[model samples]
Structure formats: C-alpha cells, structure tokens
Target: MKTSISLNQENLSLIPSDVITPSYDRDKVTTSIVHIGVGNFHRSHEAFYTNELMERYGILDCGICGVGLLDYDRRIYNILKDQDGLYTLITKELDGSLTARVIGSIVEYIFAPENPIAVIEKMANPAIKIISLTITEGGYNLNEATGEFDFSNPVIVEDMKNPMSPKTVFGYLSQALKLRMQRGIPGCTIQSCDNIQGNGDVAKKALTEYIEKTEPELLPWIEENVSFPNSMVDRITPVTVAADIERLKTEFQVEDQWPVVCEPFKQWVIEDQFITGRPEWEKVGAQFVENVIPFENMKLRLLNAGHTVLGMLGALHGYKTIDEAAHDKDFQFFLKAFMNEEVTPTLGNLGNIDLNKYKKSLIDRFQNIYIKDLISRICLESSAKIPIFLLPTIKAQLQGKANITRATFIIAAWCKYNDGVDENGKSYAIEDALSNELIRAAALSHENPIRFLQIRSIFGDLIDNKTFVDAFLSSLKMIREKKIKECVAEINSRLS
Candidate 1:
C-alpha cells in the first residue's frame, strides 16, 4: 500500500526555504512564545506542540517569535522568513510509524543581536506571554562548578559593560525586562526547554543574578513580574540529511531539505505556571504537573546522560549513529547496566518511571534507523552535562556498594574522547565551550589520572570523597590502558 500525504504549495519543493513563507492568516497567531536559540530541538519539542495546539483548537496567538543571538544568524533569519515561519516536521516511529506535518508556529524570527532595541521591543510586547529557551547547557553561560552566571566570561563582561551590545543571553533578558518594566508590560514567563534539572529555575536564577550583578536597576521589577516554569522536554531529532529529503518526497509527497525526523515518542512535562496564562497544551498531550523536579531529574540524569555516554563511546567505538551504537548488543547492554546499577540508586524519588516501559521505549528510540542523531552533538558541554547527569550517580555509587567500574569506564572514555583525535589520527572537531581547556586537560589526565580528576569544575566537589576518586581513578587508568570496549566488558563483568 502506498502511504503519502499530499503537500500543500509550501511543502512541495526540494529546498526547505522554498516552502518558507509567512502565513498571512497568522494575524490570528500572535507571539505567545518568545524562543531563544531557534535550533532543531526547540522546533521539534516545543514549537511542534504549539503547532499541534493551534491545529487542534483553532486557537490563535500561539505563535513563536524566534530570537537568534547574533547577526551571524542572518542566514537562518532570512531562510525562515522565506517560509513565512512555516516548515515541515517529519516524525518517525520505531514500529514503522511516520507522520509528515507542516508546522506554522514560528510567526517570525529575528536576529536580536543585530538590532537590540528592536529585539527588546518585540520581547516587551505585552502579547508575548512566555519566553522559552533552548540555548542548550553550554549556552546558559554558567560556570561548571558554580552553576551560576559566569560574569568573568569576556562575553558576559562585555554585556555587563555595554548591555545594549550584549553578547550574553542574560544581558538581553535583563535589558528586555527593563524595557518591559518601562512600558508596564508584564514580564513574560521564562521557560527552559533543555535537558537540565530545574531548567526554569536555573534560567530564572541565572537571569536574576545577571541583573543583580550588572543591572541592579532592573532586578526589582523582574523579581515581581516574571514566572519561571520548570519543564522536561524529550525527543531525538538529528540534523537533517539528504535521505530525509527523498523520504519526505516518498512518504509525505513533499520535498523538504531540512525536514526534522525523530522517534515517535515525545514527552513534555511542564509546570503549570505562566504569566497571562498559557495555551491549554494538555489538549495536545502535554503533561502539566505541579512540580517538574522528578521528571526533569529523571530524564536529564538517565535519558540524556545515557544518550551522551552512548554517543561518546559509540563514536570512539567507530559507530556513526545512535541506532548503530545501540544495535551493538554489547553497547546497549552497558547502557542498561549502568542505568540500573549505578544511576537508579541515586534517583530514589523517580516516582512511577515504569523502568521496563521506559527501557523498551528507550531501546526503540535509539534503534530507530531514521532518527540518526550524531555522537558529536551529544558530546558537547561534557563539562556542564556530566556534573548533573552522571556525577550524582557516581556519588551515590561511592556511598553504596554498587560497582563503580562501569561508571569509571564512562569517565575514562570521556577523557579519551576529549583527547580529541579519531582512530584515523584525524582530529574530530570538539566544539564545546571549554574545548581547548578540555583537550589540554584530557591529554594530561592520561598521564596522571588522580591529578586529572582533581579538576574541581569538571568533576566537582563530590568526587573529592577520596573513596569515589580512588575508584574512578582506577577505572580511568584501566580504561586508558585497556580501551573503552574492553574496559566496558570488564566493568560489566564486575557488575554482573
């Protein structure tokens, strides 16, 4: 049986930008969500739902005004403009399910840094009820150890000195809040859509601190007016590929170059907090919880953390995609083993996670052939990711009798990956915030495991519990000598 959805004029072309045109009828769709860093994940997770909202309910004013950080984003800004804020989202299923949907939620995209005042004007618009971000972990400009804004960063320093020519998200946020305060527009809710614990709270704290440190004048108004709703967003969207185009054409009867694909499983757990209220997102299968802590912590620590571990090890082990890595039963076994043995104990409060159900879903998502997320994308910001995602488990393991061996191998593999060269002696670009420093440190760590783990920011204070450090160091040393695959096998043996 042939399965293809006929495309409307917008989605009928090969180039994604060919179909991008501003929806004339979007006057009904006001900017309710102001999103920072208009990346693929944001498009897949949050904006995808917003599109669902409008489609299901005929609700208007559920549009997103995308805010890019720099003038360099002019390229994307222009492309999205051509589409008139419309694009295609191609969702793939593990059990061979698929959907080709055209999303028209991003009403406009602006390179905010190019015109700071205009960006502020857009943000300060009373119609904008929520400010959501997918700036990623590293994009938060936080110090790895401190979990606070790193004003010491030159970009932040520049932002502090000249808020208008801002280089940091904090500066733009505070400046926008100031503008909002001046106009008496209620400051919008700040939503964090990244894979982080206390995402909204983190954004709130970071932005508040930025204001306190740099623009004390805006702090009072911000404290009273803003809402920061914690949330958990999950999906596995890889960068677009050429095959996706042919697939789009064959499946959706549309030609889109940048169609996004992901495993059909999608979940959004958001706190029911919004200024001027929110879309009845629950109408579109979003879970509005009283507290998003358990969900956020669970997903961030287990799922995202696992994705990273698998991604790095998979690459080092010469696998290109997550599914390929997952197909290696040995690799998949290590993943499940670590999650169960080491990570679970640390997360006692994960109520009703339904581990078996989750595992089945996880395996399916990872093994979905089409949702080909690259290992390197997941490898960024190990400095930020490891502390939240893995360290707590490591700490708990140290406090208990769980084998630290598997955990040790992961750390070792990370150190090895950070050493920054592929098996062919070709250098893989390590595009992390602290890439150079990490490469330098990882290189030295191979020589002195103890000294390497001592890096306070990357490993944090928890690792100093000598017991964990010793175990971790031993594992790292062994892995460096034995290689990841062999070390993983050894670690699994210890666990078994």
Candidate 2:
C-alpha cells in the first residue's frame, strides 16, 4: 500500500511504461467547457473523451474546467487541487486486462462555495462555450409529482434571494448568463451529461424555470443562443474503495488519492444540436445523432433497469456486489427475462442497435467480475432512478397488458429492501434521498401491501391502477413468504 510517485504534471514521465499518459502540452490547453458535478462518471466518460481528443489529435480548445457545487464536493476539490487535477483511470476489460490512463482534460478546477463570484465569472468568460453538468438524476431539483423544477427547494430559494452568492447550479448558471448578456457575450450551450432520458430537455426545463422566476427577460436570449442537446452517457464506474487506491499504489506504483476505476466499455449517443462548437468526440467512438431518445430508452431500460433488478434482489439475498448477483443463474435468468419480455418491447426503435445483442452485452457487462460495482452503489438513488429507468417499462407493459411478473417482482424486492431488513434479518440502511419516507411507507406495507405505492411522490398514480396494485400485492407477499431466491425462480419459471 506504499507509493513511489505522486501523480502530477511533473511526474508524468515517471509513470509506469504500460500506463498511457497525456502527451499534449497542458499549458496550451484552453478551458472551453466548465463542467459541474465532477464525479467518477464524468471523469470516466466525458473527461476521458475530451482527453482523447487532446491526446490523439492535439485538440486543446475543449479542455475542461471542473466545478464542484455541493459541500460533499470538497473532497474531490481538495484531491484534484492537491493532485494538480491529475488522476489515474484504470479500465478493466472483460478479458481481465487493465488499462491505466492519466486523464488530463480537466486543466483547472473551481470549488464554487469557496468563491461564488469567481465561479460565475469563469462561466461568463467568452471562451467558455459549454457549461456542462454531470449532476445526478435528482440534482435537477425537479418536483417528483409535477415533473417540473422545484422552486420551493430551500437552496433554490436562497439562490433566488442572493443571486450573486448562489447556492445551486441553476443560480450560478443564471447569474453567469446575466453577466454574459450584460457584457454582450454570446450565450453558450448548457449541456447535461446525466443518465436521465432527455437529459438536455430536463436541464432546459429546470434552468429556464429558474430564470423565469428570477430574471424573466433572459429567456428570449437563452432561447435564441443556447442549445440543450439530449444525450445518453454510459460507463460502469464504481465508487473508489480503499482497495482500489491500494491497487493503484502497489501494482501501478502511482499514489492517486481519487483515481477512478471503471469497465472498459463506454458509449455516448448525443443529439447533434450544440449551439456553440463541441469537441470532435465522434472521432473517439461517441455517436452524434439526430435524436438520442431511442438510444436513451434502450440503455436506460436494458442496462439501468437490469442493474436495479440485480441490486434489489441481490441485496435481499445478501449478495454484496452486482457481479455476485449477476453470476447467479437465477438472477441472470430473471434479468434476461425482464429485459426481453418487459423492456425490449417498450423500446420503439434504436436506430442501428440490435436489441437482442444489446441485452446480451448488458448481461455480460453486469457479470464483469473485475468491475466490482456494488449493490449499495446500484441501490444508492433508487428513488430517482426507478422512475426514469424502470417505471416507464411497467407503464408500457400495463398499457399493452403484457406479462409484468419479473418487473413486479423487482418492485416487490425494492419494497422489502426499504424495510431495512434483508431475507436473513440482517439490517442495512436504505441509502436514498427519500429513505425516511420510503422506510415508513414500506413498514406500513406489512398491514396493507398497497401502502408502499401510496407514496405519491415516488409511485405517482401507479397505486390507482387496480391491475398494478393486484400484481404488486401478490409480488410483495411472495417476497416476504418465499424469499428472493425462490421468488426469482418462480418468476423466471412463470415467464418461461
């Protein structure tokens, strides 16, 4: 667990021969994109692509200036600031090979809470074209019931009151855009790299709603100049554990405090609607298309939903990681059935993607033993993820009156998961934004199974549908009585 070299600009040469280091001149790299929410996914996907552009073709204009908005972001802020914004990205291929690369796309970083005005000024800079974001699914601050930006959020309200010293991403963006408009600067693109379906549209809705409440006059200029392009971003970047850091130090001889480890596979399907210029990401395997919804649905339903199926059942069964559950035949069969029977039919068209092959690839990705994607990580934000990834398939299946057995079982398992006790009676905390309410509702489900769905914020009107209620009640009963394994086997057999 000892390290020989610290990762920084000067130590690039001392990095191991096998690991790829950025060859571009860092001094010449210009910050054109200011990315918010600089997390593991952003490091692995967008920053990796941008770094490739700089490393492969010497395209330095698209260098990223990473920004962290939340209080928890202080860790990343300090790590990147200390490490000179350099971190090792270790990619584990399916064949059990590792590729280490030093991603240098993030040339500078700004922690917004330290100096809000400085962050706003950087975004207002004329050279900064795209103020990109990887804020998580719930980070948009949308009201779950109404499907609009939640202006009632405390931080948002604070941002509205004190615009210059903003609290949220929207506040900084609105203030920055106001500065740009005042100085006669052209409006830049506001791109979202989150996993949400129609991420750009969601971003536009949230930001525009914020502007409408604060500065209504900025709307017309934003409409004319700014572009919000929807995108589908995929990569299996697990949260860095203590083991990951030690591995980098022992095997790679690099002491990186906040290195990212992910699966080798990555895909980005973007709508070709950037108002300002974008990086030539297509040169590095990113697909720029006319519409990204089909692809988004394909990825979300198949990959994200599939992960939920595994995570929920896996947690109940005491399986620690995604690979553990994925390796189980029962879990694999259940997931494959859910994807083929429930999800695939709902996806209208995916351009050139073969649905069957995509499903198989997803199964393969889930079973990657090297990835170590934790069940806890997969289940972290279920309240936000389920609506976007899993619920639409359920809704579509209901409309078609198709088999909802597997999907129903997953939901049942989620309810049991929120009960805070696994099948073996071992207790674990529900790591969700709505954990308190979810736990209360789930606890009430013991008397009346419909109580869980009555949480209108999460379930919406799904509780009102008699057919869904019946199936959910049945599934929840089976989960409590028969447990996850037997329940999964029964569902798989029933679907088969």
Candidate 3:
C-alpha cells in the first residue's frame, strides 16, 4: 500500500491488477469528440462511457479531447495534463462495495482561455466530429424571462466586437464552424450534456443567435449543416475532495491528482443525430432513442426535483449530507409525498417507466451512505435550480388545481435557506450567481414574506396566485417557528 504510484501513462503498469485500466493502446486513439467544461460530472459520466467503448469494443476513433474555457477550469487542465489525461474513477455502491478504474478516454486537453486559436483549430479539425458541453445551466447565458441568448452580457458584448479572439463558448463555436466552412469540411454535431429541458435545442438557439447578431452571414450555413442532439444524462458524482484522493491512494495504491467519486449508477439517453458520425455508444449501455424527451422528463422531475427538495430542507435541518437527510423518516416521507402528489401529476406518460419503481430507486440512490453526496452541493445555485427543476411542477399542479402544499414548501425552504443561516444559527455561504439579490430578498422576506415572491425572474407570474402564496407563506412561517422535522410532520398530517 505504501508503494502507491502517481497515475499517468508511464505509471499505468504499476497500477494494481484488480483495478480496471484502458485496454486499447492510448497512442493509437484519435480524438473525434471535443467536450467543453471538463468537470467531475463529465469525467464520471460521458468520459467513462467512451472509455468503456474503447476498452471493451475497440472504439478507438472516438476519443475525447477536453477543453476548458473559464479560469476555474485551469485546475482541471493542470490535473489531467500532469497525469497524461488519465485519472481514477471510483464508484461506491449502496452496500459498501467499490469499483476502481483508471479512465484514459480524454487523450488531450485544451485550456481555451490561454490559447483560443488552438482550441478553435482543434474544433475545426475534420477528425473531431462532435462538440459537446457540460457547462452548467447558467453557463448558457440565457435570459430566464425571455429564454433568449443574452447579447447584452459583458462577455457576449466583448465576443461580438472581437469575434476572432472569442471568450464565450458560443463565440468559440461560431468561429470554429466558420473555419470549418472555409476549409470545406463537414459540420460537426453540437451536443449539450447540460440538464436543461431540450438541452440540445437550447444549445442550438444560443449558438445560432450569437452568430446571427455577430456574423449574420454564417447563420444560414450553421442552420443547414449543424445538428444539436438532445441528451438525458444521470449520475450522482460528488465534488471530489481531499479525502477522495487519499482514499484512492490508500485503498487502490493509485495517486490520482483529480480522481472522481460517484455512485454506482449512470444513464445516458441521447437522440441519435450526428452529422459526421458518432461512436457506437449503444454497445456500451448508452440508449439511443428517436426522442429523449420522456427520459429527460423522468430524470429531471424524479431525481433532480427530488434533490432540490431534500437539499433545502436538509440544509435547514442540520444535515450535512444527502444520505443523512434521506435516512430520516420524516424527510423520506415528505419527499415521497412531494414526488407523488405534486411532481408526478405534472409529468406526461413516461413510456414503459414504472413510476413507483423509479421513485424507489431515487430514494435508494440518495440514501447511499458510501457516496457521501453533500446536501450543500445540491443546494448550490438554488436561484437557477428552483426555476428549472421545481417551478414547472408547481405551475403544472396549479393549472390542474391539485394540492401543492408540499411543492410550495420546497420553494419556502429555498427562501429560508437563502437567508445564509441554518437552524443551528451557523452561517453558510449562498453559492449562487444571484446570491446578493437573493440574500437581500431573504432579509426582506423575514419582515414581509411576500417580498421573496416579488422576484419576478425566479417566481414569474406565480407570485399572484393566492393559493400558492398562502401555502408558501404558511410553510415559511412554520419552518421559522418550528423544527424542520416538526414542520414536515405538520405538513404530512395535513395531507393525511
């Protein structure tokens, strides 16, 4: 165990025999996909699948080349570069079992901010057929109210003025596609791995609108040639901490600089639309469907919405991790009711999906102790998440005139959580783009509970609904006056 070797191409042989490593020759693999925002989720989910295809099925032509746009991505770029684009992935199961694998799917990386031209050149390469993204929901730079690409954003403004020296993802894509057009190479597919509804369509809209405003001549060509396929990806990959790195070194004798720890579950349902071509990912457990809407809806509503519910209430109840909160009986009961009564009614028919079984699996996933998924991580960016994950169900329930007390409580808990203080009076930072605005609103809500609803961008027209208003106020008051468990019990009692 003391002879742990640093993870890299040269040290691959020193890695233990029990751990799975790439089977194909790394040098022979060529890059066909360029993934932006190469964070932990991409490592654990998309890159892992590609690695599977390469090792098991000899799919060497579709290797991934990671591109990092923002300054924060420098950390990832350094880690992957040091390791020769190799890292360990450890999947922790519910029953305390572990699976360790060294993934080498990312053959190369580009820190785009440092050298934008190189990134564009790589994208323009005829060999790279797909450009994918895991840039978070906020990264799309869309106006929430209008759902349009925000040209007024400072970055977009800068990109518009100097298109060749681009900064934003849309800018880079536009320039790269222009290069490809000039070189007479076929267009590549633009795949969005973000969690937004109709993510591919969103990516297409954002990129095309950027082109329309800055370079109108390229818009028509982009529209005709490029295809953006919607995809639904699911995996509970936690933020890798120091403990995870040490755990890999101690247990597996592998010193991965940026190892990712996740639960033993991953699902990717992609629309089968590729311009040049795509890997036979279906051979390695990926689902290629005509439409990805149903699967997207199922995962977003059941898993993501449930995470928000647990996150807000869990943070307020002094629970640090999702598994800790999910293990509590009251938390579990409230979550089930919220999903069945409020969320499920809003969902359309999920083809061949057993709703109850899916719900059960979500609970099991959340309660996986070995994963140590932090509640705070889920609670990050509540402003963006509330609108995307929780609001749709609330809107649907209101239209149907269904009981939405639990759904309303989800919002109320978020409001209270935004106050930057937990039930034990401990202060925590509100990690959100709108943290300042949300904190100011939360302070005002303490004096006038209606103030939080008036944030039109987040609440929209729902603020005027008397039923939702009353329910949210009532829940917020109960959470302020009583313990979270007591508030949950009171809400459940009303349901009974």
Candidate 4:
C-alpha cells in the first residue's frame, strides 16, 4: 500500500522518479508570456512545449502566466493555483502506454474575475512580450455569418461601457495594449492558439475593432508596433475526469487535482512574424513557417473536420467516445472515405506532407484506445465548429464539383443529431451556443427537410445550390429511413 504524493513544488522530490519532473528552478523562470484562457488544451499543448524547451535548452524566460477570463475558469485557476501552477501531462500512446510528465511552465495564474486589473497589468508588463490565447473558437466573439467581431454581445457591450474593468478577452486586451502604449512599452505579438482559420488575422481584427470603437486613439500605436502571428496548434486533449485524477494517484503515486490527458501526437506550426521576441520552440518540435495557412488548412480540414464527422455520425449511432466510433469498421470506413474524398480535395499546398500518410495517421490517432475523447466533447458547439471546420470543405467541394456525398450526408446527420435523441431512443442534450435555434430548425426538418439548412448563418447559400440541396435531401431521407450505421456504410460504399 503506497500513499500518494501531492503534486506540488514542495513534493517534487517525493513524487515517483518514473514521472519526469521539471529540473529547472521554477522560481527563476519569469513569466514572459501572458496566456489567456488557461484550459486543458493550453496546458497540454503550449505549456507542454514551453516546459520541454525550458527543461532541455535551459530557456526559462518563456514561462506562462495563465489568465482565466470566464467564471467557469475559476475551477482550473483554483486547481492549478493550489498545485502551484504545476500539473501532470499524461500522453496516451498508440501502443497503449502512458507517459506522465510534470509541466512547470505555468508559474503563475490569475483568475480575471477575481482581479481583472491584475491580469491587465500583467499583460501590460514590458517583460511579457507575447500574449498567447487558447480561447477556443467561440471565444473570439466573431459573428459566424458576417465573419466580423460581434459588437452586440452583451459582454463586449459592457466591456465598451467600462474599459478599466473588462469582461471579454478583447476588453482585457484593449486595456492592456493601451497601458503598454501609454508606458511606451514596445508592442508584443498577440498569438492566437485557437482553432479558427486565419486565427491571427481574426485576433487582430477583433481586437482592433474593439479598440477602434472604445479607444480610437490607440490605433496608430497598435499599427506601428503590434503583431498577430497565425499558428496551427494540434493536440487532442480530452477533458479530465475524476477517474483521471484517481489514476494518477493509484498508478504513479502522484495526486494531481487536474491532470491533462492527450494522445501522443502533437504538432504546432507558427508564423515567425512576432514583433516581440518569441521562444525558440522550433528546437522543441514546433514548426516555424513563413505561411501557416497550408498547415492550418491541412489540420483544420482533415483532423478537425474528421473529428466532427466521427462525432456527429458516432453520436447519431449511439457511440459515446471517438475511440469507440473509430474502432467500428463502418465508422472507420466512413471517416476515412470522408477525409480522402471530401476533405483532402479542399486542402491547399501542404508542402512536404504525404496525404496518404497523414490521413492514415489521423485514422490511427482517432482510434487511440486510451485517449477516449468523448464524442460529446467533440460535438460541443457544432454551430461554431461546422462553419469553420466542415462548411469550407463543403463550399470548396461544391465549387470544385468534387465529392460532396459524405459531406452532405454529414450535414444531414448533423440535422438528425440535433433531434436530441440517438437511434437507440436515448435523449442527449445538443450542446451548442445556438442549441435552441438548432433544435427548433431540426424539429421542422420532418416537414421541410431543408429547414436545418435554412439557418443561413450556418449553411449560407448552400440551400439554393441544387446539387447541394438535392444531395442533402437525399441523405436526410436516407437517414430517416435507414440506420445511421447503414447510412454511413452506404456513403462509404458509394464513395469507395
């Protein structure tokens, strides 16, 4: 019977030697990067890379000061703060092995709701050269249809009204950038680690728009000094559950409050256009490219769109996890076909990447037995995800006259999924920012099959395209009449 060692700075020596602990003195590591939206993905991806860079190269200036902007983030803030901003990163390998490492890159965390000024001031610090973000797709506050920053959002509205005490990411950023400008501190690079395509451009647009409205005086300074570098960040970090915490204690004798669990696969491709100096993360498995668009498209169209395919189809078929869906022969066939036929065609130049190898790796990654990425997690906020991840491929396919069978079927499947009941009659809540609208439209799909597509904000003019509308209706009809697995098999057969 072994007692668990609490994972903290003081207990580093007491933790099992098998677990790789940070060798660098964390106290000496200054927070040079102020990261907003400290979530599982940030910890597993960005912090993990920074930790490796520090551990191997002895570069300690890139330590992260994580700021939580949302009320829900208080949980992670409390957990990481209690654990001294130290957490275990457990990578579930393809061979069913787990590699556990303690990440110390996050030396400090500020829950913005508790003290917004602290977060703003921390960002204003001249030493903090790069302000990175992992605020998810929805966090940018972009209107999915207009492709612009939504100013009408209540938080953005309130943020404009009261700039000093900010609510949204844009508000905090505006306030901080203003402080930096007033103090004559050279502007830092605002790097976006979110999944949106052209993430950096989106960040700059959102922030500039917010600032132009709130503090028009700061535009010239921002134009002269600020930089927003686009980046493509890939790592499948599943939401941590209690069992993950218990497993850390039981197997490794390390008790961690929130351990990040992800697949062994990780990749980051960044544009080397930072105004302020950045970490030499290139030495630590991150790719620095002149243009991150090719990488971004390849990842987003294939990996992300692939996840949505499995997630929607799997949910409709009553599968709970990605591994469960990927393990199924039909689901695997459907996903592979969708990737090869629908998505690969839309991808731009990937340079040296082998499409066959990449697609195969994606299938293998999705089937990782240990990751168990929840379909629900993948399915969350499909309203936002579909527009960014899937629809582009659809539009491109529509334009190119390429394979739209599986893509159309996916949209149909998404409609059927929004019915809020699986084929097995199990009721599951449809998780989306526009859940109510989706459900309402989906309910009308029975009478008018195109009702789901009528959400012009999402589907856009695809409803008017005869090829798209006809295929969509055909798929929806088949979905209503046949089992989801049968529908997937049919599409797989047709595509093959």
- The C-alpha TM-scores of every prediction are 0.90, 0.97, 0.98, 0.98
Structure candidate 3, residue pairs in collision: none
Instruction: State each model's CA lDDT, in order.
Output: 0.76, 0.90, 0.90, 0.90
What is the C-alpha lDDT profile of model 3 across 447-482, one tens digit per residue? 999898988989989988999999999988988788
Better of 3 and 4 by lDDT: 4
Off by over 4 Å in 2: 1-3
| Between candidates 1 and 3, the lDDT winner | 3
Please, what are the lDDT tens digits per residue for candidate 2 over residues 206-228? 99998998999999989998999
- Residue 177 of model 2, lDDT score: 93
Q: Enumerate residue pairs that collide in model 1.
A: 20-82, 20-83, 20-84, 21-82, 21-83, 21-84, 22-84, 30-61
- Lowest summed lDDT across 10 adjacent residues in model 1 is found at 15-24
Which stretches of candidate 3 lie above 4 Å from their native place? none
Per-candidate RMSD, Å: 3.7, 1.4, 1.3, 1.2
Number of backbone clashes in candidate 4: 0
What's the CA error at residue 258 for candidate 3, in Å? Answer: 0.7
**Residues 1-496, model 1: lDDT tens digits:** 4444333334434333433333335667777778888877888888888887787777777789998886666766776776666667877766676666777788888887668777777777888888888887777777776777787888888887887777667877888888889888877888899877888888888888778887788877777888898898888888877888787776546644456776688899999988778888899999999998877767876788788778878877777778888888778889988777777777776666786688667777888876778887778767777777877777677778676666666776777888777554657777777777788878788667666676777776755577677776777777667656776777667667
After superposition, candidate 1 runs with Cα above 4 Å error = 1-27, 165-167, 250-253, 422-427
lDDT of model 4 at residue 412? 92
22-67: candidate 4 lDDT, tens digit per residue: 9999999988999998888998899999999999999998999999
lDDT of 1: 0.76
User: Weakest 10 consecutive residues, lDDT, candidate 2?
Assistant: 349-358
